[model samples]
Target: MLAAAAQDADREFSFNEQEFRYIADLVKTKTGIVLADHKKNMVYSRLARRLRALRLESFEAYCSFLESGDSEDEMGMFINAITTNLTRFFREPHHFDHLAEKMSEQFGNAPTASRIRIWSAGCSSGEEPYSVAMTMAESLTRLSAYNFRILATDLDTSMVANATAGRYRLRDAEGLSKARLAKWTIQDRSRNEMTIKQGLRDLITFKQLNLLHDWPMKGKFDAIFCRNVMIYFDGPTKDRLLNRFHSCLAPGGWLYIGHSETILEQRDQLIPMGKTIYRKALR
Candidate 1:
């Protein structure tokens, strides 16, 4: 009897047609994130607050508000509410390890270029880009000789603003080593707050960018770190974004992705270098 009741409850919890269609449209129009039927509750939980904040009574009315087209600011708030930004410094260590090795190879024999350009796509709250900067600083002693720049971008404007500040809680810098913490981060003696050092801070530039939109990057990059960002995107979207990354990379340049992600198609364009790492196939 209990098992039957539980089954009935689960069936009743399913998302209705209106909600499903609304979420589907949102996924289609803004981001390539597809919300399956099973994700109905997740949609409600994430967006219910928007309705409450706007003093709307129903999801349908909220959808109408979003569609009214006068509420672009609210639309941005909706995107921010729905998007997940779970990330950390060196969240996946292997990518950084591979990146360090690649940088050495690129700069080993030849005189370092005027700048080593790197992009940290979906660099949530700046941890990943700052991690890249710290890694480069640690690896290269003659930092003045080599101009190193990291472009960190994310779709969330709030996140971009936070990344620009370069301030984080002590807990956020947990996994970072003491030496790195000392060299790259500064702690406020009075408040126990932590901020990225000016030197490391200057090495990175943070901007809000929607990957689905036209890329504004000018120069080609030697290495692009776009890890853990494609899990939300469908296969075709992933392919399109990867192709864009390919276009942005220099000849024989490297690309690193989250360990779980892989190039579903276009294998010819990017040669598999190692686990979750690919190098652009030199034409």
Candidate 2:
């Protein structure tokens, strides 16, 4: 009994049930992320860092400040803190395999005839986008004759800056093969760091984007990788975003979602190609 009382005192900030719900609602409204009752502790733990950084007293103060400002800058920091970024190079290798197949079918016959555009939505820290670039560069033998553009976007500004740097710790290079590393990456063994060779960065454009907002991109994408991002959203939010994606995709373009994200609705619009990969039915 005494230990339990003492443990309660160790909590850095007071997170009441009301505060938790308020935050959950705000996050859902702003970012389309659903925070459940079970996630109360997780929410407190993540947001506690923000409270500490601002030297604020509680979740109430943080939420109050958020409400007081229509400030996009502070809001960015809040979203950055809340959004989970768990990514590494070549994650879910099967997606890359499918991508290679799609590329072969597209470029094999009319290699130089058409331009290829790929969107790496929710591209965390550049890994997924870089992996996409590497895969395309490797697959095409007659690359010089064609044009390819990869637009990598994230809700987190810090993540966009990091992706733009194209510099990653060497330890995270595990997914890369020897030939890929030597060709596309410049490594510093002594510092335990690696930066992407300029050639790889040349193919990618890193942008900061809030998926819920109006997109500034002009052209429809041939393939869109929004992996692992929509899992946090509720059914309605997912539906809306998928519809938006359908509109953004070119005729017969592909939409690749996270392995964990299950799509139950919109079968008529997004034809399942198996493994959570879908093709926008050419309408």
Each candidate's clash count: 0, 0
- Candidate 2 lDDT over 1-283, as tens digits, reads 5854564478887777788788888888888889888887778788889889889998788888888856466787888888889999999999999898888788867748478899999998999999999988888766656778999999888999999999999988989999888899999999999999998899999999989889998889999999999989888889999999999899899989998887778888899997989999888
Tell me the tens digit of each residue's lDDT in model 1 across 220-250. Answer: 9988988777888888888899999999999
Alpha-carbon RMSD, candidate 1? 3.3
- Residue 90 lDDT in model 2? 92
Off by over 4 Å in 1: 1-15, 189-192
* Model 2 ranges off by over 4 Å: 1-8, 70-72, 111-113
In angstroms, how far off is 54's CA in candidate 2?
1.3
Every candidate's CA RMSD = 3.3, 2.1
Clashes in model 2: which pairs? none
* Cα-based lDDT at residue 197, candidate 2: 96
